[model samples]
Target: MADFTTFLHFPISRCGIHVHESCYGGLPVADPEETRWFCEPCQYGLIEPPHCEFCPSRFGAFKRADISGRWAHAVCSLYTHGVTWSQEHTTTGVSWENLENSVFGRRVCTACSDKIEARFGVASRCESGMCKEYMHVTCAQKLGLLVDETDESDDVIVAVPRYFFCKKHTNQENLKTFQRRFEQWEKAEGRRITVHRRKKALSGAEDALRIQMRETLEETIREEDRGKSNGSVAGGEKIKQARLLNSSTEFFDRFETKAEDSGLSKKEFRDPFYDIKLTNASHVPIGFSKEYIE
Candidate 1:
């Protein structure tokens, strides 16, 4: 089974992976194994590819303007603000050669491609789904995926949400409220995030054991809290706690595979080879009955 790091060597020798915001940070590689190759960076969803600087995205198409002058992505330049480069000169003008190499063969930027889409609309996509015409990087940014680089090499991109109002449509007053909600998610789900990190760093059955232990610990804590609050303890719970405290190798037959995506074969899910995705937080609905909460 090919892993996330696997790349292809066929009709499409994709040099690098292209990731859009809606599709998470970006696909690590263009392989069929990761059918759902998406990142779940908690706050940020998917990242998108950067547009060619020569495109009409924001500054308007300045094609053939002077491949003479060295160019750089807007985001990269931002970091090197105030640095000056001359035109026609190699190192003198273009401080960022990596970006210059991107347009070497003269590729069009997302801006011009978008115009073509406008004149003869093309398909564009983001979290909200697909778009009819080609939108500038700015338009895509407005939609959510804020591309920092306007270079060529950068293929994969991350999608950033617009103003935090897309999902909940929160007003200024609600911003802090939403922040608190996310903070709570982080606090309660910190271990989950760690689990995700470990999954990426480690693989195979060892990773599976880590996840199982995390879940088991979380469950134990919840149960302990519940018992303390209710002033009552179940007889079995004592045995469970004792087992948990005994050792970390308490498999207790909690092994075997778990199917992540549907239609995938019955391969045992010993542990995921890639990073774990956290689509939504583990939170109770706002308006649950008191009895339900209890």
Candidate 2:
């Protein structure tokens, strides 16, 4: 079982209760139960002790950049570098230090298999509160797991909550798992709401429950709309307007009469344009010669 308050431990630790049973470990610990003994120095200097920052694997030949000060697997490094972090950073409004301390230190996203960067990426641990599995914002979107955050109010723009549900929760038997996930999501969102309230002083009108209910209602309406006939009441009205505009011969006749009264030919009305001829300046004025004629 995982605690809802404390950050999730790395996923690799979920393999077995006894850490020594982990096959990925380079060396076995004297006391498998204790965290301190999990990463005892290996006999061979070839495999160093520290866990790779990017993946749940032991490092062989790794890369360490000054920005993160941590070693990561070659593939993980490549993947992390490829991610566009700037947009996410701006949206989350999370400081690098808070991200580092609370979210990213030992965590790796199960979706991308890349080391979660505190400064660059936004991620959430599995809401199941069982495994240490995590998902990146982009990966969740790609999977269609993320909720549509757009709404008429600033609530969506200001504080879009990201919730993560583990794969196990897909079945009805895992109702407890689902409940745990929701509880965790609410717990996390509570802190976000506090910050939002302080910054904008949002009233109780848009409570967490209201926002959730509104989203549910909106989703239901969308589904209902989709189920209806393609030619909806609104769609039919639009078609009628288009047909009226197309078939109104009297209106066209009136327009043509106006055009004729304005001295515009049908062809000219369709493609009205002017042709100008360039001429050199004349010394004499128009309708008058250089000297007045007798």
TM-scores of the candidates in the order shown: 0.19, 0.23
lDDT of 2: 0.32
**Could you tell me the lDDT of residue 266 within candidate 1?**
32
In candidate 1, how many Å is residue 37 off? 4.2
Candidate 1 Cα deviation (angstroms), residue 149: 18
Model 1 earns a TM-score of 0.19
Query: What digit string (tens of lDDT, one per residue) describes model 2 on residues 113-208?
Result: 322122122245555657666655334323334432323244333323435455544323444554566456556445543443344322463233
Local accuracy of candidate 1 as per-residue lDDT tens digits, 59-157? 211111012211223322222223222221111122222232212112212333321222111112222333223333333332333323223235543
Q: RMSD in angstroms, candidate 1?
A: 24.6
Off by over 4 Å in 2: 1-94, 113-123, 148-150, 153-160, 170-294
Superposition TM-score, candidate 2 onto the true structure: 0.23
